[model samples]
Target: MKQFWIVGLGLLPLVAGCSLFETNPVPPSPALTGVSAQDAAWKDQIKRVRGAEEARFEPLVEAREAVSAALAQQGVNDYDAASLEEAQQALDAAESGWAEVANKRRPNGDKLAAIATDAHRATRLAEIARYAAVREINLEKLVAVNDQLETREQSQPTRQARPVTGDARDLVGQKVVPDQLGEVSFQPGTARMKPASQEIVRQLAGLLERYPSVGVAVFGHTDNVGPSAASLERFVKANPKLEQQAPSQAEKVRAFNLALSAARARTVAQLLVDNGVPARRIGARGFGDTRPVASNDTQAGRQANRRIEAVIVPGPDSPEAQRARAENAGS
Candidate 1:
């Protein structure tokens, strides 16, 4: 017993030293860390959808409640079934995905992103189901009443193959408003579209085609990883290739970053045009490293900064950007 105690006592300092040397050995799951902003946004969107509805359907309402509870760290957990009857199952899936990440079993990012999308869709379904379920009478009478209306609706002119000129306002409104839009990005120091970005651009092209009046503006930015001026002489030396001695390295770096951003924006704009969106309805710009929505110190943050910010522009008549649109209509 004394020998055992002595051995254990001797190992205590070793264990303590090992722990002291370990620094951030196990970081937080990238999936959960990256999606904090997206989760908050989805929560708000879900609330708005529920608020806008005339009434709430039972299944959808239950699902919404379950999702709310799940997100609150209640209801279903990693250990339970944790199923929501409706769209927010994706939310639970997202949580479970993080657990999987912690165990080093799976990558949760793609799955969570997909689920976040479904949760958004679920909100719409919840809203639509509520209105469709309401009846002035019992189920039998309601079914009889809707049968004829359903047939009439079938015969009505479909919105499919709608020409770009079709009621511009309605067309604009009909465009698929993606859940959490405008988060597309590219590879480091390259204008090449990440695979997901290509798909998003494709979707945006279809949107512009459907709504000719709805203009799109894209801006590109860069992570702050290049030359910075702390002193005047060093600044001039940084841009060694420039013949003009007065031009600081910071100025040269800014110009390079801006150009890189512009190239990316132009690439996206050209893709939109090629995909059938009119060139006159899209504008692309680059702000370089001047604007950053996230820190540039981490990989995720840097990727977020190195992005193309695509905005849905208001109508030509809207007070916002009316002059800018007129002057720079995708030129």
Candidate 2:
């Protein structure tokens, strides 16, 4: 036991010495450690480049989120692979841009500084370019998905004969008047329609009875108060909170306003369904502040913007209507 202890103690110094030597190994590149001043300058240059890259990438992330949301609207749930590929391409391009600046090592300090700045900007621009390209690709994919959905819908079985006098025939064509169905509201931030919206729903049912083939799309809109993605998230969250450290009165008011706007559309759709509007005939879609009918810069404008519009169209007999119905049924 004593000999074993002695042996272990003797080995400790060797292990420590090896670790010390490994840590202080000579750097291979002159660019790594030739001159302290040059090394510091190079580090500063790299820092600038990284800072610029971060700045550029931050907006790219936002763009990616926007594209992702658009994709989701078209029914895509995962885009990680595409996003990663885009980020890699951006990094590659940025690196190439940096290489060009690195190769032109000027003796003039001012020129070197300008070159570094330019390289940093170039890297940032590259990231932005990559994001733009990826967004375009995502948009194309979304369109393709929409097309597929349309095609699938078109292939659905249709009624062999159109009813000449029944409920089906009456709804073939009708216009949806917004004023007739008044004041729709829903539970704050929920898709469920409120009792107050029942009158409008009954009106919708009457319209359906009048024109059996007419289908209505319940479109929900909201005021533009925050980032589009954030607005959507908030709409989905179904809760209100302070925008920052402390709840500002203004922020609270805005949150309530937005919540009400979101609720209105949901309420309208639910009421329509409750009042005997066929679930298939009624399409519920939330725009979440994207398509604003009125300017959201003012209170009046926000009020006007936060509305539910029921766009009426030809029912199952119409090519588009039939296709959509079929797709929904199959889905």
Best by lDDT: 1
Q: List the residue pairs that clash in candidate 1.
A: none
In the predicted model 2, the residue pairs found to clash are 170-211, 170-212, 171-211, 171-212, 171-213, 171-214, 172-213, 193-267
Off by over 4 Å in 2: 1-180, 186-196, 225-264, 317-331
TM-scores, one per candidate: 0.38, 0.36
lDDT of 2: 0.45
Cα lDDT of model 1 by residue, 1-331, tens digit: 2232222222111111111112222222223344666454333323223454332223234446544543443222331232324435443543443344333222344543554444444444333233222111112232232234335545778734333344444333222322234456666656777888778889888766665445655667898765334433453455566536555566666766886787788788788767877554555666789877578889899777777765444433333334443443454
lDDT (10s digit) by residue, model 2, range 194-220: 666666678777867677655654556
Error of 2 at 317 (Å): 4.2
